[model samples]
Target: MRSAVVVPETPVKSLFAYPLLLSLLVGGPALAQTATRDPAQIQAGTYAVDPGHTQVGWRVSHFGFSHYSGGFSGVSGTLDLDPKNPAAAKLSIRIPVGSVSTTSAKLTGELKGEQWLDEAKYPEMTFVSTKVEPVGADKAKVTGDLTLHGVTKPVTLDVTLVGAGVNPLNKKVTVGFEATGVLKRSAYGVKTYVPLIGDDLQLTIDGAFERRD
Candidate 1:
């Protein structure tokens, strides 16, 4: 006669715990995904600008009564960065002049005409950084040549590192920055109405860059 074989049964609590533990292990990184402003976390490499996530905004005083604002899209750029040597960073940016948009349709059309930006003559505006001076752990002064409206001028942008991290959706390393500068419209030969439309233009750039590899 042969004895009956017996099988050990799994504990009820362990059965529920197994799947829960597996889920935590698999989703831990996604659950903890976040961008940080720490300069030490910046990765050293070449990054291409994320045009869909970058924008350039400009504001000017309208007849000294109120501020008028507009923005440019379709921005493209590249950045070579080294966290250990921030000063050695290089940047290049391109902006399509025709992408300028404002609240009013008529005003937007006028901005693209010969009287204002004259996009027909100068189809693109570009900036190439000449120097990068770190001011703080996450701040820098970037001096570059800004070519706009058929003219080029030296402009200094106060740039702040906003965040650096791996993008959740694409899993690519990404960095973000905010830059501000003031430029005289007349200096770039975009002067249609000097004092009337405000000669000084306040520029704010929101840039996002993703690592190439």
Candidate 2:
């Protein structure tokens, strides 16, 4: 037999590196199967209200009577979307509290007062998202903090992504969605009347934001 050649073996060879490498390779495809995992792949867009098409409307119980509804005229927002990673997303909206209309100036003033929106003191109501959780292929839950009547509270919205595609006007990708949530006005220090105008306020928003240029 030829002279044996001795070779030093590494006792601490990395088995750990192999799986990590494999995971990096296969993990992407696997995670993609459920939702997007690429944050950088997501797009950011700004949406201006058509004013004609968009609306911010709310309804509340009227002394245990029929549901009374009213809408706001000025509404605007922007959307941050990550198609490759749905979890990494955010949305924000702002509306003028004084824009509430009820077909009566007296009612409008009342809405602006402390009994309702208290618009003179708090001119605007805003919602800023904290986290995004995809509900499915096209639905999500947006957890955010909403400041209304100068009171800030955490709120969650059930969101349905209407669609995302190209826009001819701006020549950019656009996304549309509808979200709804309900909150007790009193919870946000909006407490004033209980059964007269009702405490449960239902919020509905129809928004469309386009990719920024």
Candidate 3:
């Protein structure tokens, strides 16, 4: 008798599987929720952005059906804090557009093309705080120039101090903050599919910095 023929089943894969897997591999562990504490009495100085601990995420309405989201890595920046005078605080952040990741590879490729971010021409985007307004002991309104898609626009973000303390493992003073803002892509000349893809996008930044001096 002829040997029975058999076929192997193929595994199903989602478009976002790779992105999810990459996020998991890069993200070490889930952060524990700490009790709300007053902002640390941080010394007046400059702090270096901890790239590994920084995450810049964005979400946009897609055809009014869902809010699709993605994130960018490779962040490098500095924070000049003025505890005595919070308004004198300054922040300079740089993000490489090429580091943007999405759920789909095709979408990512398109975003890097001329129709969208045009990453080749504008490889990096920056935000330099123009003003800082302290609203509370642990919250502030940060206004800055956000440059993207070869265009620059004024944007404001609501920032809150998460926590600040000495890191047990790194043995360094670390500060954490979370910020949220909204921007219209069309204003920045990224009007690919305006209404359909969504013109307004929400941005959230969770960052950790180590004191340099």
Best by lDDT: 1
lDDT of 1 by residue, 95-173 (tens): 9999999999999999999988899999999999999999989999999999999899999999999999998888889
C-alpha lDDT of residue 94 in model 3: 98
Candidate 2 residue-wise lDDT, 110-198, digit = tens:
88887778887899999999999888777789999999888899999998866556555446565667899999898887877775878
TM-score of each: 0.85, 0.73, 0.82
Task: Name the top TM-score candidate.
Answer: 1
User: Looking at model 3, which ten-residue stretch has the lowest summed lDDT?
Assistant: 28-37
Look at candidate 2 and tell me the lDDT of residue 119.
83
Whose TM-score is higher: candidate 1's or candidate 2's?
1
Which is the winner by lDDT between candidate 2 and candidate 3? 3
Query: Which residue pairs does candidate 2 place in steric collision?
Result: 36-84
RMSD of each candidate relative to the true structure: 10.1, 19.0, 10.3
Assess candidate 1 and give its TM-score to the true structure: 0.85
lDDT of 1: 0.94
Shift of residue 186 alpha carbon in model 1, Å? 0.6
> Candidate 2 has what TM-score?
0.73
